[model samples]
Target chain A: MPLIVKPTPAHPEPPAHKIMPAFATRFGPKLAGEVAATDRLVRVNALTALCDALSDPEQAHGCADAGVVETLNAHVSGGQDAPTRVLAAKALCGCARDARAARAMVDAATPAAIQGACLNDAEQDVRMHCYDALIRLGGGPRRGASSIVAAGYPKALVEKAEKESVGLQPRALDLLTSCLGNEQGLAEALDAGGIATCLSLLGSMEAAVRAAAGRCLAGLCFDMSAKDAAVEADAVDTLCALLEDPDLGARRAACAALVSVTTTDEGKRRMVPAEPRPRDAVAAIIALLAEPDAYLTTTACKLVANVAVHPKVRAQLREDKECLPAIDALIAGPGTDQDALVAQHARIAKDAVLWEP
Target chain B: MANSAYTHTTSPKPLLSKMKKTTYRAEDEENIITNNIMFDRRVVRGNTYAAQVVTHNTQREVERMRYESERTLRRDATCQRKERLAKPSTPPPAEGRAHIKAQTDTFLEELSDRPVESEAVTQTEAILDRPPSPLFIPSKTGVDKETDIPGGDLFDFDIEVKPILEVLVGKTLRVSMMEVMEEAELDAIQRRQMEFEQMRNAELVEVQRLDAEASRRFAEKQRRFTQETDRLRQQAELGQKVAARAFARSYLANLSELAFDQLEDSGHFVDPVEKEIQDSFIPWLFDSVVETTNNHISSSSCVDALIVDAIELASNLQSDVIKQIKQKERARVFAVEDAQEIKEAEGTAK
Candidate 1:
């Protein structure tokens, strides 16, 4: 006699996909399977636990390898409820923080889902997370903005950036900087007035905003046309003005940018505006060399190298003979990583000084 | 000065030139690892400065720089305010928006009033509805028109003689001579084309000879240009090196000359930025700096430079932390939005 059991049918289960084995012991099949479970509560519990486990840097890589990215992506991007989707996206965000995991998601379905949420999702938090996820993956804040600016010169984008929030504007300019990393990008940046916009932002009230603008300015100095544009925009004077700022971070960033601007012919010509004898920056920048700041010293040395290309600036530097011993001291000092950066620039600038005319 | 005892060495092989791998001295490495600020210039050259001197110089320099920058910022802000007061008041937002819309869309306004973007390219104008030509007699006559239309005379009348002459003489010598001359000279249009090709060939030969000479001249010019550029570059490099060293020396001199006060009783203004810098960045900076400078038990450091670097590092750290937190929050929000989308989709599926 066989006892027949009739199955009660109410909620139909999803078709099961082939399950991949979890590589790590802590997140074996049971936890992994729980994320894919049809039961909502079970999935949530598993996701939260896995997300917590991922907080430890030691476990991030292993979890990513355990195929958690795909499951998280599905939960985040698939037909999960708002709260569940939020939790899943948060967990995915944690994963995105780790570069390797971010890359894994990039190859998976995460980007499209994240982008979709950023664009179409009604919730502000959800839109924000999508933007964060994209940035974590080095795809920039707004991929559309990045790609649009990338497609041609950044004219409209720079104008659009001006009206945006302080944070978004800098990011947009930074996006322009990335776009300007190549020769073509340089051409495009020139077309977009990147130099002018960045120079304008150099005087921003916010230190963070100024730093971003300075960074973009530094990037633009790499190409000839852009360098020419920068010259026209009075970048040298503006950058030098920033060197005198009270904030050391902005000053250092400004000095770093000055290093690039001063490296070119146009940069040298514009080092001091066509003003009275030499510019005040020549002295202010020289003063920076004596400071203990590694970044400032490095850039100051490089700026001097560029400015010294002008005989007037060179004469000024020569008049102040102590720079020789100062640079010499840096070269012969105990070599730390910071020392290496300072010493390298100091050495190059020193040679430029020591070169017999 | 304490720096005099160090006996600075000049390696004819320029330091940091060409950016080769850095060669570190073993003693230097040991000093770094041990965090010992030896009396060595490389370890700590500013040990000569008295503690009082270091403090005085740092405080004085920071105050002066702060004062100068603040004064300038205030001046600029006030000037802007003054300008705003002088100008007419801006319209209210709703009115302003309406004004902007009107300005953009009103077609009857002066064309000059339209604000053109500097880099914007103009779209090419297109002809939408070109009319068909009545005399488009296509040149693609696959079959000879004379054979198809039996109308040789219609087109052949281009150089016809009178009908009376043709009937009276029936191909007289004068008429035959005119026809021979026309055939020999070729069509007037055809003759011009042949002449042009011949003239062009002669001109081309002459042009080729001139081009060869010009190319030689160009090559010479290029060589001179290259040589001149090289010379200028070399000179520029020399000047740059000189300037770099000079700037460093002057800077060090200024650092050394902090005469109890770098400012000669510079007038003071109210200090506001100082508090923000101290509260947010300076204390943490001192914490890290204590460790950085701690390595040198006996060695002394320049407080002026140290404070600046510490301040910079602290400022950068704060910026980095802020960015990190913002990123984290945004990532979470985006993920939730994506999940919500999925949820909506699922509901529809159900």
Candidate 2:
């Protein structure tokens, strides 16, 4: 017998918006009808079809308008078999891409349902789908984020990110980033060793995962303790190393994370190494000032301003040829030519770089 | 006529002296001059034309004439009635003096009956007017100049609206780009979720297959266990049977040989004569022969011993008999001789 290699499944192109009405009208009633079937196979089939249809945002929006989120919420909180529940959770996750559907899902207590299923179910696939759905559905609003925190989702996400497949790590990290939207979720994630997990994943071989981890670290560093922990873990050096990464996303995320890190005084001091180094963090941030992306340039300026508080970094800025010019150009740039926030932070960086202290 | 002319007002005083003093109280005056009699200024009489066109002086003259005529008639009637009383109680002292005294006294009485009055006679200065207020002089300090600038020169609408337009354009572009990015993100997440669903489905199938395989293996193990148990039990039973059979055969072999040997050794298979002799005749013949031999030998021994003893006794007896015979013969011979000698010896012995 020869080896049989399975081809990667091709993603379907979504139908045009004109057809969504008809698609929704056809699938909506069918889903509602079969979702309540006495036979498990019928319910599972219905859920699979719903999951497939929910992949298109237009279709998802139509389904939400047709009240499919409520039906899925029932299965999430029901005593259905793992496969059926998995399909329901997957469908809910896809539906969440539509903002209205996400809102509808949250209003339907889908987060609480997915949290329950994710926690209580013994099956890995079921738990994973529930996790995915919660990631898409839970941290949207303050109420849902609080509920997710109360359900201990951050700890579970951290654990899954730590132990699950590489494909799932970035998603879990992104969910953790969302969890950091609120203080309670941030505190919960921190208590669940989120800093360590994010810092460790910063060394991931996959650039996407590294970028996601960097983003999560950036979010986590909003807390004072997380900043201290990051500094203590030598994450400053690690992120500085990541500043040279080939992937722009990883670099941007690292830059954002470094910005968060530099908010604290210790992080500021850490930005300027005591010894001579090959790659200077301050110079790297100054170099980022010339990038065309306003967000990157803005974030880089913010990081520079934060670290320029240190006299050593200020001296380094004075020694560097391009730092002041770039910052001056940003400050002198016309309002129409540059982002307001970028110009504002560039002015702040200039002031800090030129300060005597 | 001369007396009348000389009668100065004493007569009028007499006519009034008889009259009762009817001083109107404030209340009575209000009652007598009721609102019906007192015309309201706002009331329009039926002859509106006459009321409206009537001059103030004419209306006053009419009112005065109507009251004056009534008063004159009432005064004349009272005067006529009091004419008798008009004569003084005493004749007038002198006409002129009486008239003078009467007029003076009437004037004093009238003065005494009048209400308290204050008369203010203001003598305004004739045409004493304040000098006309000095005419305000129109004075102008600064020159009034006006200049007209065209609306275009003041501001160009296009230029003025440029910054606003740029802001609007920038805001619109930013919002649209953000929307596009959001849409792409949603599409990406949707695609990822779909792929996850597929992977999850495959994993589900694989898990189910593994579960089925596990159950099948468990059933196979149970069947094998039962077969092994049955084989062990049969082996034990067969071993037990073999050991029992071998032990029984070994035990019965010695028993059968012992039985046959004992039967043959007990002499039940001997010949009839040998069997009879051995059983009864042998013992009988031996006992009889032994007894006869014993009897014969005893008799013969007894006879032989008796013969030898008799022979010896006979010899002794023969010898003794011989001696006795000889002695007897000798005694007889000797008796004859001894008779003679015995007679002698008997005689000697006696």
Candidate 3:
């Protein structure tokens, strides 16, 4: 006779039902399980689901618990198919938004892995996804940006920004921006001719690409050599021209880049050259002071402060009927209740303009 | 033959040299017998035919035989000791009673010195006040029961489980609804967060615009004010720098001072305090006092006129009211007469 065995319930009482969002209950484990399956089609379907689910930040935060990050990381690092890897990278890009998952990915060396994939992946789309993931994971916990820089992604990003199509160029520049926070990253970006590429992109028709390029150049200007290289690349003219762009973001970024460019003494001198009777750079900055954007105005005020340190620039500003009065008005404090940050910087500019040798 | 018992060989057998001998003393050479010397058979010693026993034992053999004998004796002794130990010693006098008797308890004195009697005495312990109640055994009552009741007969499954099923369904529905509510709350919060961010960005842009506008207007106002101040100063400077004014000022630079000094010396400047009091101060004070008096009179007269006009107006209003009352009385009488006449006419016509 067959032996009759009593079956034991895992719990004496039914477990208190966990009230989870229906989507989490439905997709959380299914995605993880299918991703863990050895079958390629199953993983692809699961990753596609994950990519779709991750578009919602709430789900992205919830997806970390599904243990899909490790599996996605495996697909990225392992010799998976390009589309699968691309999907994995895209999912990781979403997952990287979650702090805990981002820390996990960084600790697991996923940034380096993604950097490697971005460089080595044959498919352009896969590379793009990897770059996106890397950029997201960059500058996060565990010195994520330094790790990407250490992985030599900066030069690669610069090169890609230079050679890639308009669509991909912004991503590359964004990656460069994320990576080029330190001196070494800045050096690598500079050595890769990033300044020239960014200067060229300053005139791009795409506002986003121009903004990205402007941000990259702005980031590069933090280092002395990189700043000098950018100034030498005639970036001032391009950046000054960008100040008039219709896009607010591009204009702000250009203003910021010019601010960074004028940080050094040489940059200051370059901003207000001695030779020309008409210096459009200073005029562009002066014009920005009148812009409706207080942030841009504040930045223009800072640029003026930096530029007005030059005696010649100060004299020229005093000579310009509009520049000094506008600055004086800013210095005079807001007639209404507003942010005094702009007024404060304007005072500094006024002081600098009025400063003697 | 005895005298020729010593035999000599012409060649010497190989032998060790004694040239490095430690002793210097000499001894009789012929007394030492060498292997070269031989004794003749005719010169035999007494009892040569006696038996010569050949001993077969070497030192090693003798030692081996002695060790074997010693090992046998040691083994026998060890076996005997082991047997003696294993013999159990005659059962220890039946649980060592005799040994225990021979031993003395330290707390109880042996008292062997005292004579002991052989008589035995009995000692008893009183019984417990009450023996513990006898172990309880529940007595059997009715006959042992065994009923084979069908499960359905014991309880109605559907009727009994309805509440539980209801609870389960209710709990499930409540939990699902709660989950949906939580998700909706999260979504709303997220949407609010996004809206807040967008609002913040837009507000920042607006604030910047407003600030810029304020600054520009302020700057323009300041510029225009500065221009006005500069223009005024320039006009003043231009007036001072006019050729006629310059020539006149140059020609009369010290003349006004001299003339004013000479006039002051001649008492022509006068006592300004006295001059002000007599000429302008007195006249102004007198005119103000007279004008104040005149204003008061005119104002009082005007007030009297207004009072008189008010009285006349009040009187006229009273008279008009009386006339209107009288006219109303007359009209009422007339209306009554007309009504009466109309009534009479109606009667006559009827």
Candidate 4:
């Protein structure tokens, strides 16, 4: 008997678009022209290729020309065509990392339209692109301040700012916070129930909301009248409650707020309770250390450790045995000193134990 | 001896003359011998020599006279011996007859030893022995406790057989062995069996009805589910159509705005065709073309090099929007087709 063998045919090479840099570079300049011609289908294909090419930082700068900036700005200002305008907005934002392009986008009259498009566009992609543009516009010095103040951010955006600030494009809440910096704008936000809104956002289920609210409160805490308003509004209790928040960023913000509020002698004295009275605020910090989340636990430990050393607050700490086990458990666990705040607590706990008789 | 010999010859002649006078025949001689053989044999064997001589002389005459008798006796003895030899030996019939008679006598003796009751009385007793008492013993004490009477007291009076025997004589007698009261117990058992059978049949019918009802309910649920699914499918179709229309309008609007922006930037301004188109045409047109082209090919291509190059700058923007819409449509279509194929395959397999 004879054996028969079958040979496998060679696979064909994929089409040119499927190929890499060579085709991209070869066709890049031509595709850029096609994108400018307003041929919808051809422009989509070309821009898709261009975006791919722009992923490389070196290639990204090349795509950031004045013509591209003009096209993007035109689309952003263009009404009714949400899908195309959104795509253009996103590409412009991507290219806006370049200083010149970023400045050009800021100078363009369509920043408001882009911001509006982002907030209200029917297409999710277009709205997301508007968000991307806003983030880019607010990321830097030149247009960051002005564009943030000009963009009439929606309430939903502020709510989103509270929930997902980190995952959010950087400029979302930052822009809102920067807008709040203006006295008139701050007074308006407060007048428009912005204080209650911020307080409510601080208690949001989302960590980002708590973090953004905390950061906003920190900024607002600088003004003496704002501080008085915050204290009157019970902003301290809200911030202290956030010390047990699951998100690391929110917990860190709470710790920072506590540190800032206690920095002044008068601030410390005000936060401290009257003599022989229990400090519920200090107890709240001690309770936060019992949270299961490592970040919240560590932050709470540090806050308590700081409060424990205060002459006025020391008597309360010595009386509370609950603080001792949590301190011991934190020091016994791995990575106790990994975080600076946790390390500070460890040091304070060591001193507190050492100074005991 | 000579004188006797001469005399014997002369005597024979004289004897012949004498025989002629009485003519003794063979038949007659045989008869005489048959009659005297028993005594003649004894006389011949008992005589001495002298007596034998005298007897011999006498015997000669007698023998001559009784020769037939002697011959007949010898022949009879020979026949008896031959007959005895022919038959096998057996006990006598008289002994067997005696034994039968003794057996009959013993049977009669035993019969006599029985109580001397009359035949009618025995017959009545046999009949009475067959029927059990209708009354039952109330307890293990063997007393009719319900009546406060001992069981033995029930049959205390003697039964007279004489008058009954006279009445029964020459009449046909019937003896029944059946227990009379057992018939009622049999009837009760039969009634219980009928009731149990009725109950069993009713239960079977009820079970079948329940099964049918369950099947009906199951079919009803299936029909309801099918109707609900059809309603949902129609709603989903309407939603998709609306979404598509809105998307198309948005695409067209954006295109016009882009074109207007370009015209504004150009050194030479072109005349507008339609105000709506002028403001929204270029961007919308760009988005639509990109969406259409993207539906055909997902990968970036320079297949239509000239056309592709003309829209290269805006292609990424348009393609992003197109990709999202096309992806959603593709998933919907694929899911519908896959579900249809799966249902068809399952039907075929079943």
Candidate 5:
């Protein structure tokens, strides 16, 4: 293919108005040439570079005009090797980072279908890249699968998130945890079953799953609307139960999550049993004060403080008196088995109730 | 106003020289205005009016092709000499006095001669003050000293109007060009708005597609989770049944061993000699063969009979244990079969 065009010397420097079009014209055919190259290996290498180039937002902006995006669509669907297809998807991910680039790709191809092909790739690496790219394309982390499920980019895009392979679910949840930092991102996530997924993952045997879910729920619990949604999903009850996870990391995450929940009025009601129970949210964290893991114990203190923030939660803690004694046991130690941080957290938790603001 | 001026001048210009009788008779403003400046003024005015008139004509021609600047330029250049005949800017600043214009001399001569003929009928005073006679004429003696109208300088305003004319022309050209550029700018804004709309619509479509996909995936996952839970329950049930069957087997073996030990300890205690006698002497055979058989209540055969009874009891106990083992094995097989059937049915339902 003739990709290069010699400039007419009659006008060495075309006016500013014509420069973009001139480059836009050159861009399309060159990419098409690369796509049409009979040498598969060469095509793959060229496409990798092309995808890499387009990942640059500036290059992505120009890609659509140059027909680069359309050709890339062809490459992605062109029955390339696993690596080649994955690379093409990685490029799309770069483009998806920019609104304009994402629009361009959407203009010419079905992102769902492309992602599905990458997802179906038997290679774990291929699937991983496809997922990463999906997240960039606004399928952001925990909600990425849900977004893909809702917007079937592929003609037959399947929701395999339930059977989430290794490396996908944890990463997805972790991403969503951070996504919750922004209001809009959190709203989007909540709309996409983020609450339910977190609830489900809370019960998962995998510690990573439990941890990510806990972190995500922690963010979710901060918002009243999300908290209400979580309550409907029995989030407080689930998280309160999770405070006793054998895995210290999971226990710490659960503690953090419960902190957000118990801070809310409804959460406090659920955590403090209607009838005094020794194994409720308050009792659970009290038990954690005796734990050797300083982080877990500290996390437990945070939950205790958070729960104690609620008037009812505070009254219940004072009524049970189990929490105070547990905390007293932790602080009364002769500094041998007791972690100072744990002791500090225990004091803060105690003060959180006794020294009511 | 320029057109009105052009039309008004066109009507009276031809009649100026041919007018046979009167000078300024009509008192209409146009006529009085004409009469007031008719002679020295008219002569000067005539040349100057022609120059001004020429400017109006050329300006109209230029205005006609204002949008096509090249065309207007060509038209102006093509008619330059013709227009210059009347206009001032060609040799500029009204070369009026130096030329002393031949037409000006004739017009004044006609005016000077007109009263001589009219003097034959009218009063001498009438012809003297009639606008033409007293007008200063540059003669062999001196320049027209009686007239304040600068001979050619009357039209010197044309030179000043030259720069003004250039400014006007530039304005016309600029307005048309600016109009075109403004229109282009509007078009660009509209195009950008359209592109934005298209992109926004595309994004909306993408969002919708994602929404559907999320629904579909969640539904699938829900189904899978349910199926998995069912599958796990079935597996747990199967594991429990296997454990129960193993326990039953061990318990049955212990029961059989205990029953066998009880039978061994509870057996009749018969001496070897007594057991041999009972085997050798059947009760009926001893009664028939021995005439001297005393009627003893307790015979030696009694211990032997007890020994035989004990042997019989032990054999029956072993058979019963064997039968129980068989029953338990059958029950375990039936339980396993039930579990397998349940698993198969569940798999098919799935």
Candidate 6:
């Protein structure tokens, strides 16, 4: 008897549907299965699938479920692969747009892992995504508590950042600084030994790191205790040093931070340097008025103008003839006339002399 | 000498001789006396007296010569003063000539620095004299004559009329003829005509309302039918999910399938489920998802999308929708005509 070979039926392909899954479906069992699977390729594919699904509004609704939450939590708890964990963190961030998803994310133990990924991830994009996610997570519950002991997870992250080398330090420091924007988080960072870290970062070789540190210090100084902490850490001196940074942007950020710190009476007093005002922040800004870049000059002039208005500051500036010439040079420089900021400074200087008794 | 001469006597001469001698002698004595005086003076004065007289005469001559020399000196002084007074009063012809020379030199210097070519200078001078020709030519007079009568000229045919006859015997004539008709009768006729017009307007209004009602009903039915078809298609595509959810799934499935198929075809396959989704579900699900996500995203991002969609939709729909409305209005006119015919037949039957 001849062996008969069975012919396979030609299955017609399904019609192409261009619809995206809703949020709930994006985080549904199908995506969860992909997330839980041990196969690397499959896991990557599933992450991609979830990303695609979340890209659609309807599909994003489907993914706003416990499945996405549980999978993300599992990855944060056990996963060691940085890329996969980064993707998972991103998906959670996507889901976090919904209150339920945000709550679920907050309940999950993934914040620490996310913070770690933000610190250690080689890809800048991934790190940025992680920071974005953490920011969206309400920066966690212990945000504005007075002491680090009161701030459990954030405190640990700060400690870890404090122990890390300078190379690995900026990311953690950035995350901490980002958290400093929040009331509770800022308070916690200040209490959890964030002042020294931020001050050290202010001296960082990277201009962006210095800028971030200055920005964080500005936030910390907004509160009384944090302001005192900053004063003790010599934040004024550090920020004043950053005013001389080769990067104009860093200098602008430093000047902005100094302006914020000195705007208050207590902050102004605390920010005054010991020993001949070693980092005369006002003087530093006045010096920056000579910078060739129009933007930098404008920013510096604005800062100077702000400082020149205070009666005491005005008196101090009047005593320094060097400051007048620098300001004059800034006013006379190319493109300065077009800048409203430079013009404002010019007016302030005029008022300082003309209006004063 | 005189006493001696008186004592002596002399011999007498002849009488004629004595007489002649006396006369001649007297005349000689007289001449002698005058010459004697003249000569005596000339002798007494001698050369010295004559020299004195000549010296006096020479002195008078020298005085006259000195006076004339003084007069000539005065006249020369007066002429010099007059010349000095007249020097600066007017420029001399030589000075004017010098000025012209200086001007010519200056002009030559300027020309040397920037020489005007002879041809170009002549051309500019020529152009300055004549006005440029106009760009267009005038048409011939007869070619543009008025072809039709103007509105102003048409009024020439208008006229006013007046009645000549005042009264009539049997029938009232002209003006009185009009007064013969009663106002009540005209009023009644006008009232009846008005009522007829009102009735016709009411009928037309009824027909329009019915047509509108029919069109509205038809539109509602069409909308329902379209919606049903869409719902059925969505159900078929999404299986059993709710409409929104199914739309979402179908969209995601379609996008996934497209991406997967592209990947597979490119031999960069990452997943196979991406190829299993459908296409029709893409846009609907995408739009729904985007709308849902609008609340989730930043307000600025949502506003950006909304603005873009609004501009695009407004531009696309403006003319098309206007055309559709115009077409519907034309159809309504035809429906009104049909209703009018039906009404006329009903009126005849009644």
DockQ values per model: 0.00, 0.00, 0.00, 0.00, 0.00, 0.00
Q: Residues B1-350, candidate 1, lDDT per residue (tens digit)?
A: 35542232321221221122234432332322222334322322332332133333344557666876797679779988999999998667774354444465646665566686544243422421333234333344111112223334243443454565666687677767765685465446443642343233323322332453377468879999999999999999999989988997887786744643544334143246765667757887887688667845324455545766776776676466446435644654767776565556446644
Residue lDDT tens for model 4, B133-227: 34433334211212244344343324455556755762423211122234455457544653343233223322333443466457778988999
Tens digits of per-residue lDDT for model 6, B1-350 = 45541222333221222323434324443332222333332123333322323333344557666876797679779988998998775456774365343454534543255664433121223533554444344443211123344345332323211121222333445434454353355456544653343233323323333454467568879999999999999878776566768788778878878888888778696444444333445666888789878766767677768877876776556455445444544554767776555456446534
lDDT of 2 by residue, B55-133 (tens): 4445555765687679767977897789968776766677556533355453454436568775535443343343334
Per-model C-alpha RMSD: 67.2, 39.6, 44.3, 64.8, 35.6, 66.5
* Each model's fraction of native contacts: 0.00, 0.00, 0.00, 0.00, 0.00, 0.00
Task: Report the CAPRI category for model 3.
Answer: incorrect
- lDDT tens digits, residue span B200-297, model 5: 33233233334534764687799999999999999999999899889988878788667767765564445577667667656557865564344332
Once fitted onto the true fold, the runs of candidate 2 whose alpha carbons sit more than 4 angstroms away are A1-30, A52-86, A98-104, A116-132, A139-141, A332-338, B1-350
- The CAPRI classification for model 6 reads as incorrect
Report the candidate with higher lDDT, 1 versus 5: 1
Look at candidate 1 and tell me the lDDT of residue A312: 72
The residue-level lDDT of candidate 2 at B210 comes to: 40
DockQ of 3: 0.00
Q: Pick the candidate with the highest TM-score.
A: 3
Q: Residue-wise lDDT of candidate 5 within A75-126, one digit each (tens)?
A: 5666767766766666666566556766665556435556545546666665
Question: Where does candidate 1 chain A have its weakest 10-residue lDDT segment?
Answer: A1-10
lDDT of 4 at B20: 25
List where candidate 5 sits over 4 angstroms from the true fold. A1-39, A50-70, A77-81, A94-115, A118-124, A137-159, A172-194, A219-229, A232-234, A244-253, A274-302, A309-352, A355-357, B1-350
Q: lDDT score of model 4?
A: 0.54
TM-score of each: 0.40, 0.44, 0.45, 0.37, 0.35, 0.39
Whichever of 2 and 4 has more TM-score, that candidate is 2
Q: Which one wins by TM-score: 1 or 6?
A: 1
For candidate 4, write residues A1-357 as lDDT tens digits: 211222233557754334234343444445446556565655555556655554445455444542556666666666635455656766766665446556656666446646656655556677556665554555444455466555555334555554443444333554455555455445545554555556766776667667766665554454445556666676666676676566767875665556444333344455564533233777767776666655456445545544544565667666778867767766666654345445455555546433532
User: For candidate 3, lDDT tens digit of each residue in B22-104?
Assistant: 23342443333333223422123333334243333333356656776797679779988999999777545665356444445
